[model samples]
Target: MATEAPKRSRFKRTLITMFKVGLYGSLLGLIALVVAVGIAMSQLPTYQELVRRDNLGQMIRVRAADGSTLVSLGPSFGRWLTSDQIPEIMKKAMVAVEDRRFYYHPGVDPVGIARGIQVSFQKDDKVRGVSTISQQLARNIFLTSDRSYGRKVREGILALALERKFSKEQILELYLNRVYFGGGAYGIDAASRRFFGHSADTLSLAEAAIIAGLVKAPSNYSPTADAEAARSRASVVIELMRKNGEITGSEAFAAEPADVRIVPTPKQNSVRYFTDWVLPQLDTLIEENIEPIEVWTTLDPNMQRLADQVINANTPAGAQGALVALDRDGSIRAMVGGRDYVRSIYNRATQANRQPGSSFKLFVYLSALEFGYKPDSMVEDKPITIGSWSPRNNNRGFAGAVPLRQAFAQSINTVSVRLAQEVGFRTVADMAQRFGVTTKVSTHPSMALGSSEVRLIDMTRAFAAVAAKGVAVVPYGIRRVTTAEGELLYQHESDESRVLVAPHVAAQMTDLMQAAVLTGTGRAAQIGRPVAGKTGTTSSNKDGWFLGFSSGLTTGVWMGRDDNKAIPGLQGGRAPAQAFHDFMSRAVASRPVEQFETQVAPPDWAETEPDEEVWYDSPSNQGQMVDADGNPIAPPPAGEAPLTQTEDPRRPQQEETLEDLVERAIDPERRERPQVPPRPAERAPPPRDRGSAGDPVERRSPTPQP
Candidate 1:
């Protein structure tokens, strides 16, 4: 009996020792946690500063020329709402989905964290977020989105501080006022208005659920982006609200997805592309200030809507289309970057650089004109070889001799190459740059056929220069920028004297392009009024382009796949030209018909200075060539041939002077006028066979390595 008693005492002593060790260890850990939290607390902003802070960030509101809102560029906030002003359903939905234990927890929820840890273990260590409403508010206000242990510690400390400083209603109010929703919308009020077109006080149960669901992933759950997905997410939130007893089963059932009608947000609008392009230019135009500014852009809302419709209707499946329209003064009238801005935000019109194909011939032919080649000047269109590279016409058969007008209209590859060679390739590259083509131009032989990549906007501006009668056209979107209080910040101004191409040269080029629309590859772009354009089809049908102008407006259309793969049978004249035709027909209907000026006098600034250095070597000169100074050089000895020569045409009965030839080229009788059909009130139905025999396909030439 005595031995048993001693054994029992020993057992008791051991139990006491183990308990003491555990107590000491837990106390030490608590002390360390307190110290760490104290350090984090010291780094945080004071509660008063957080409460008083306004102006989350600079917001830019872009408006169309007609004073319609196009888009808002940065964080957009609506009026703040007090706890009473906020809808009850919105508050209940937010709490049910975001934090069920908001009022019960001291800041962080231990139960939610434990559940999250369990879920992570069960799901192969995929971390699950356990942030309470307080934690999210803390992070949104005073923290960056850094996912690290130290950041979490700071976040938790801040949450504790916020909870201690404010009541549950105040915390909820702050959260609802500051949380980000998709499409630049911040705060529940803004989100409510953005998605439902009404204030938060009028939110339906389903609408409230939809906004609450966006808290987890604003972009993924935005109703504007994907309505079906948003509805699915909202259903989940409605069920959560039901389970939390915030609403009855009947209330959840009544809150159907169909009951929610999502209003179109600015990001979903097609004009986002234009506004996005214009946003960066603001930094250059105005001083950097924190005040919200309004940008009045040159966008024509009607034209923009039409452009969007045209691109969506014309772009083939599995391919993309872009259109850029500019006024004569280089004001961007309309821009559609792609068929669907919601599907892709990449502005193909301004951002994509693709080969322009025959569309680039504008520079080549413009260079030819500057070098004193008349549109009627005959050039050989037969196959030509340039340093191990042989280029042929699209048909692979040659028209032995053709006028420059016919050659350009047909997009004859060999003719372009010959002209690029005769007029130094460097001259052609410089001409393109002078016309506002900002992309680097290659001086290679194939570059004449548009082997070099160029942006759609730059190409459109070059055409706008032609439409502007040779004046330099610097494309611009913003007409004026002003503060919200009506203080003028910046306004657009132009230099009328900066001439790009000579007026006469631009006139002649217009004649050539008019002929192209009348009887060439761009016949698909024929509007009732005078229209001039060029069609471009790149290698393997990778890129298609049509740049044209009429009635003081110039528009460029590009169609291609983003992957740079061949869109089978795609040609510039097939879709791009037709799209241009449909858009321009309606766009110019309100205005009176205006004829292209056949005879344009050079501007005063341009009259005195020589337009460009001419290196004219007439094909009819019988092996003789002119130097840069216009001095004729002796022909090569008999039986010796020039590097390249036109097939000798039957000698003219009487040799014609250069002026006579130019006069004949400019004569209305010699120019091929389009056979005009009776004008209809509405657009003519697109011809079924857009890819007819005459549609010019710009053939790709093997680019010779330098």
Candidate 2:
């Protein structure tokens, strides 16, 4: 029994020893597992950060045609600036606040890390960072902006890698260049120039201090918007600079408030109007190695200014205006997109399509003239109601029976509608398209009165046809888009297509337009020189337009609101006409006069009846001078004396020489006065008695005039 008890005790002791061994082994395995996981957690973030840099943001630069940089788009809204240019005071202030031993640390500061560990346990806040400048840079440049344990572990690992790869000064310089200093400034150099308008090398003590203050929070210290807050933040930087020995206490105290002379950048007037219109045209002209070429347009700076001033002076507040000027050969000279371009970037002159209203009547007249209808063709201007649309005259009263010349000059709506119906709406719309007005013109009859919308550029092109004497010349701005070395990149070859109307027909139309200036609704656009144009006013006064051309230049003006709201009582002759007049007068200041073919009435025209009687109806009659059945009468007094139409002997005969005709046409105002075209020295006319052969001294007709 004693031997069995001894054996049992021995077995129990062995079993107890084996159990202790298993417990120690399990504990050792668990400790090893924890250490492995800790190391893995540190390395995972470093791998991820390297992968994230593949699509690092790129900066976009905008430059003028002259290769001057207008501005730049940066990653994280921060511009990268150089590090050597950073002010010493800003560098010292950063060191004082972020890490006192930044220069001594290799990625991680030992003292700072120990202190962070103590704080983490005592404060129970996982908020611990003993990062050196290199570590902070790695976090900003390579990692996501996440505050987590995993991120911190990876940040430290990556910082160690950076420290091993780059020197201490190199890491510091990278941090200074890559750190966000707010307002889109990435580096201290960019920040210094942005806030103080000077390079970091030239930064004053106060300026450097102010930029340093912005490092923590730029929004709180924006010198441009909040000067007082920026001053307070700068004071903090100055205090830190003194503590860090960057400056003495007395020097910091003596430093005045940063006289940060922030040079104001000029407003980015991107020439939105001209650019939008010219881009597509540019695309066609340019090919190969095409890296965003800058285009210097032919827009006259002075003309643009004048156009803006005239529009502002005439248009109502909040109203929009667009003006486009073109040289006679179809080169776009000046363009104003809107009254204030920055307020709205959608360029109206090029993009916005608006109703042309009565200004479109010129096309109608031209079409008629091309289709064998003369200016003297009689058309009744009465009330017209086609389908659901009813058009009324500007004066709200109709001319009973008017000639096409008088009707067009007065912009009579009833007469225009009648002409459209007679000549077919599709013909007019097709004619408009042939002249480069490519906007969708309605097939409806109302489109004859310009019910459809058209862009300012298209309208200008159509007018260029009139100015170019019946040629549809495509408008161009860059005469020759060339490289910096003046090698011809693209030459603006004139594509002049003969669209509608013969030269003589176009000349006749010009004559009628000239009459419009002398006595019609477009009288306001008349310059001292020979100018021909038409005025347009849409229904409900929605849009007002005046398109005209002098001897050398052609310009189109439009006035309206962006919302398309009505400006009641506004007419094309009011603001738009005046703006056109002012712009052209200034635009042609240096241009020499280019002579246009003048329209001369055939010798037989006097024998023919007047297109319509210019009846001076007494204002007392109230409505109109009408016969018993509401028919208009001849132009004469009621009873005292029906005035006799006298033929002036001073009028030069058509048999006169070409030089005499040229002189007469050159100075038309002289014709109205007591001046005559000088006779040839060899064949001078004899003096005539005023009373002899006053009735009809007619010569034989020169074959039948067309």
Candidate 3:
């Protein structure tokens, strides 16, 4: 008995020691938790954050470069309403559905937290929030909706702090104003106006219940979609209200789940396409800390209006077309993304990737010139096949042994393919890349006919490079961004770099392209001024394009079906060219007439220039000649031996740079044409009246802004 008693005593002592250790450890843990909370609260945002509410009600305005507002984005247009303006039913509905004991407890509701934990851990449905109104407000305003125990703790602390800093009435008012409703509506006022076509002060019991239920999951219970779900959710709120004694049984029974009158939400403005396209760029520039920002763009309202007029005047119904115009510096001057921004916000000008067709020949010819081929370099335009592929011109017959200039003006597919084959297909692809075409280019022989797809914006930028005198450019819309407080947030710098088009090639190419507009396929686009451009018509007329540029601006027009189906009778030389002419004539009407910077004397068709000879020597090891597409090439078939590397015997023996070649080709002292110094911008031409070579078409009545 004595031994048993000793053992029991020892067991009792061990139990007492374990209890003491646990109690001390628990006390230390409580101290650490209190310290961590103190640190978190100390770093919490000040009362000024709530007071400013800059992000809550303010709007970000997108303005033209001239300071005219194009569109305003962000937040609803509802003013903050005080608690007195809120209806009693609204308050009761929110509390009933969200927290039944809101006024009884501190900011944190222990009962609700316990219920939420039990439900989240064991649930048939997904885990849902059981936050009280104050906790919700804290999460919505001060912190993010992160599903972590730490976030919940921070929310509870912030809610307690908020309750101490502001009255319950103030908290409720802020909560009502900050919440998001479905369909881009924010605040109770916007919700009421959007859903009921009235104000929050005039909300009926049924309406208030519907709105309160939306706080849980607005998109799921949107009245505009699935009214039954909305009414069903409202019924649950009504039942909660009755159980909490906030509403009588009669009122609860009267609030049946019936269809409530809902007003149709207003559509966004006509600048929706412009705004939607600019949003990603805008987001990239500004941060969350700044207030509402003001972004200045380069959009010209008058030109945009004129573009819409020109496109809608000629475009066939049911077919969509896009237009993009840019200045020499690559600032987007005008854009007509689609027929109606409200109906379709898929900005075709910036988004659509269509085959550029024969328009891609500009790059091919540019590559030819870079390979030491002159504008007058002759290639036999006879039928030729590479491996299993053969390309035929639009005319279906070849103009045999045509000069490169005439071949380009006529858009002869045979000549272009032969030129690409001679210069090496890889060389042509490299030149296209240098011109800023980022699409994945295929080395197939069909690429000479523009079989690959490319975006309109990209091609426009590449053509703008030509207008900028051989320098590649990046088309930009946003010029600068400023905050509402007038602080500079961001400013765009032009992205320009020297490309493959040398000065001589730039000059010679301009002369050829000008001939295209003057008498070639693009004759429909003649505006009586010096301009250079190309026309492209894809297979079965699926895509039509007119890419052109004047001394001042570069414009690209694409006409086709969005689904890539053929539009019979459509050609780049017809509607697309007409639209280009209509838009360019109006666009430059108020400006002065300016000729291309490197306009070579209108081709002396009687005799070739002295320096038109191109020479290349053959190396002994060049036996196994392979084309760019990895096909073996047979050595020159008969008289096609490599030309001798010799300068003209009659001409002076002086090695000249590309600039000198261009200067001599166009300068008045060396040629018959007057030399015009290149201007940084074509806008250097003074605004004046200039007469057109053709009959002046009367301006039509302006269309309403869509």
Candidate 3 per-residue lDDT, tens place, 1-706, comes to 9899989999999999898888888889778756755665676566546645666655677887678767666764466677899999999999898877778777888887887677778884334558888899888887888677778888887777667667788888888877887756678887888788888898888999999999899999989877888888989998898999999999988876585787754433335666677768866876764467788898888787778777778776777878888988888888877777767777888888789899988888877665445566565677766655678887788777677778888899988886666454555677778887888876666778888788888888777777776877887888888877788988898765555565556777777788789878899998878778999999999998998987588999988888988998889999999999999987877777877765433223212222223333358644554322233444445776532212223323333322443343334354321111111111111222214832112221111001
Q: Relative to the unseen true structure, what is the C-alpha lDDT of residue 503 in candidate 3, on a scale of 0 to 100?
A: 58
Superposed by TM-score, candidate 3 places the C-alpha of residue 271 at a distance from the truth, in angstroms, of 6.4
Q: Which stretches of candidate 3 lie over 4 Å from their true place?
A: 1-49, 52-165, 183-217, 220-295, 299-322, 334-354, 367-391, 398-406, 418-427, 440-446, 495-504, 526-531, 559-567, 578-593, 597-706
Q: Candidate 1 residues 91-149, lDDT tens each?
A: 99999999998989988888877786687789866546679999999888878887665
Tens-place lDDT per residue, model 2, 1-706, is 9899989999998888888788888889657645654554455344334323213444433333344444444432233334555556667767766667877776778787777777877886675755677668778876886766677766776676676666675666666666666666666666766667666666677777777677567777777657778777888877877777778988988887655565454444535556556655755777753332334456655665577677667776668888888877787767778877677777878888999998888777776666445566666778866545677887899777776678888888888876665455666777788778878976565676788999988898788788788877677766555543356677667766655556656776787777777789989987677888888888889999988788657788888988999997778888889888877777786777665675633334323333222344576763353322234644344564433222222223323332332343234342221122211111212222222633123332111012
Residue 224, candidate 1: C-alpha displacement in angstroms: 5.0
Q: Which model scores highest in lDDT?
A: 1
Ranking by lDDT: 1, 3, 2
Q: Which ranges of candidate 1 are over 4 A from the true structure? A: 1-74, 95-136, 143-164, 181-184, 213-258, 264-296, 312-320, 336-361, 371-426, 439-455, 480-490, 537-544, 559-573, 601-706
- Return the clash pairs for model 1, or none: none
Each candidate's lDDT (Cα)? 0.80, 0.66, 0.73
Would you give me the overall lDDT of model 3? 0.73
Q: Assess the local accuracy of residue 254 in candidate 2 as a C-alpha lDDT between 0 and 100.
A: 88
- Quote the lDDT for 526 in model 2: 71
